[model samples]
Target: MPVDPDKARALAFPPVTVTVERGRLRMFAQVIGETDPVYVDPAAARAAGHPDLPVPPTFFFSLEMESPDPWSYLADLGVDLRRVLHGEQEFSYHAMVYAGDTVELRPRIIDVYTRKGGALEFLVKRTDIRRDDRLVAEATAVIVVRDPEVAS
Candidate 1:
């Protein structure tokens, strides 16, 4: 089945809130091989002028995934999980986020398009991260779905 671009654009997803924890930040930094003390140590981050342990690059994506049933939007769109590919990911930071900060993520579909006569569908989702209703960062993700009808 082909994706309905209009429907996709009209989709409204509920917002999710996540609290940044120092231990989790430290653990994530260790897992990602981040040697920056500011990302793992509150004192180091404070020494570096941050109020708390700073979040690592790309870590916001994981925070956004804190949503329960993160993949439910795709499922609701009737997308085949097996044929979906992560095409691209981008982030624009407006302000620094740190441990102990509670951030809210509001996601929406920015665009939806098809190519190769509908064999490839691209869904662009943009998430706005806010702390106390103040914009902190914007994350964009492009999802590519291969149409089995045309590809096969």
Candidate 2:
């Protein structure tokens, strides 16, 4: 079975909740090769005028990973995991996210499209990150589903 655009449009992902821990922030900073002290040290972040360690660019994707079994949900929808490819990812920030902030990630599917006569289909999912009713960021992800029949 192929992806049903209408069903995909109605798909909703369970929210993931996480508290921004300083240790996790530092670890993420180090792994990403971030040299800015603000990313690792709370004092440095404070000195830089931030209340706490600010999230590094692209870290939110990891946070979104907190989304419980994102792929399982797709598989449940009849999407074949083996044929899926990570197409693209993007983020838009409305406010700063800092350490110690408890945030919730509410994700939902936005659009589904196809190409090459349905041989290549794309699933677009968007997750809204919020803190106390305030939107912190919006992350968009594109997953490409390839038709096994079209493989070279």
Looking at candidate 1, the ten consecutive residues that score lowest on lDDT are 36-45
> Tens digits of per-residue lDDT for model 1 on 68-109?
988888888999889899999999999999889999999999
lDDT accuracy of residue 101 in candidate 2: 89
Q: List per-candidate RMSD values in Å.
A: 1.2, 1.6
lDDT of the structure predicted as candidate 1: 0.91
How many angstroms is residue 72 displaced in model 2 relative to the true structure, after the best TM-score fit?
2.0
- Model 1: CA > 4 A from native: none
Off by over 4 Å in 2: none
lDDT of 2 by residue, 25-46 (tens): 8988888788998898889899
- Cα deviation of 62, candidate 1, in Å: 1.1
Candidate 2 lands at a TM-score of 0.91
